[model samples]
Target: MKKGLKTLLIIIAVILVITLPIISSYNNLVSLEQKVDQSASNIDTNLQRRSDLIPNLVNTVKGYAAHEEEIFTDIAEARSKLAGATNVSEQADADSELSNALSRLLVVVEKYPDLKANENFIALSDELAGTENRIAIARQDYNKIATEYNTKRRKFPTTIIASIFNFEEKPLYKADQGATEVPKVDFAD
Candidate 1:
């Protein structure tokens, strides 16, 4: 009976020795996932800020150029796409569309010096630019965390734990087409 009890205690200890690492790995994955989520939320917040500013910008421009209906419609549709996005992939797609629409709107503005000079439009433009920077930074941070988490999830031992817990892979923000093209910043008058 004493021999049997000793064997049982050894078995229990062996189980714990193995189970502890699994628990620690699982916890690290969970923390990494949470970090990715928080970073995504940061991006969402900035995008929302940019979206919220669009109305003021659109209306201010409308006051100067009411006939530019198509641009306004395009901008509205892009904003809608962004609003309806459910995840990082969807948001990236919509974000690309919204950027295109905003670019077109800017081109339209170039036709009207008065609109370009409008203080409200200028302020809104600067604010939107800053928010875009913040979004880029947040997305970079998210991608880094996601890559680390994905690596850990796929690694041996942890892979088994991750699968059992259903810890799926997170998506990364892919750059839009033509995003790599350098803009020609000519200062020549």
Candidate 2:
């Protein structure tokens, strides 16, 4: 009877030895998933910061270029879309629209030397640019973390574990349309 009890104890120990690595992998995957989520949240925070800066920017521009009401309206609409977005994909789309609108607004600003020279507009533009940089960094970090988590979860034995645990794949942050296009600058013109 003592020998039988000893054999049972040994079997339990062997099972633990076999399962420990799998347990460790599961924990690591969870950690990576959380990191990805946190990074995505950081991106949203930065985007929100940029959105908050938009009104002042729009107002300052309005003060100078009051005739350019349509551009200001477009910016306001895009900013609202961004603020109302509930998910990452929606946020990405809205952000792209807002960025395009801002680019158009900048073009409008270029037409007015007085607006460009305004101290308030300059400060707001500087703040918006800095916020955009932060948003880019945050997006990159999120994509990196998501990629690592995805790769690890999809590899070999972890794939089985991920399937059993129902780990979902994350979507990547996509760049805006026309972002890859090279500018046509003709100094001769």
Candidate 3:
């Protein structure tokens, strides 16, 4: 009976030793996943701020350039794409599209001196530019966190734990096409 009890105790100890590290690693993956999710939320909030500013700018420009339907249409279409975006990757793509459309609209505005002089249009433009800056910063932050979390999930023993928990690798939020172009902000004078 003494030998049997000793054997049972040894088996239990071995199981605990084997399972503890796996459990701890799984917990770490969960924590990293939460961090990634929070960062994504932060990016979304800033993007929403930029989206909210578009309507006012569009309306202000429309008041002055009623005949510029193509520009307005482009802005409206881009806004719709952004609003319907389902994920971070989709949002990045839509964001690039919106930027391109806004650039085109701004080019049209160059011909309208009266629109340029409008106080409301200028205020809205400033707001949009500021929000874009915020969004860019927020996107960088999110990407950093996501990279860390993804690396953690993919590394060594953590990868085994992550696989057991079905933790898939997340895609990085990359800038869309033409994102390298310097933003035009000429509120001076």
- What clash count goes with each model? 0, 0, 0
Candidate 3 is scored at a TM of: 0.86
In model 3, which runs have C-alpha deviations exceeding 4 angstroms? 1-9, 180-189
Clashing pairs in 2: none
Please provide the root mean square deviation of candidate 2 (C-alpha atoms, Å).
2.2
Whose lDDT is greatest here? Answer: 1
For model 2, the stretches where C-alpha displacement exceeds 4 angstroms are: 184-189
Candidates, ranked, TM-score: 2, 1, 3
The true-versus-predicted C-alpha distance at residue 130 of model 2, in Å, is: 0.7
- Candidate 2's TM-score: 0.92
**lDDT of each residue in 36-60, candidate 3, tens digit only:** 8888888788878888888888888
Question: What is the C-alpha lDDT profile of model 2 across 1-189, one tens digit per residue?
Answer: 699999999999999998997898899889999999899899989998999999999888888889989999899999899989988899999999999899889888887899898898889999988999999999999999999999999998889889989988888898877889985644341
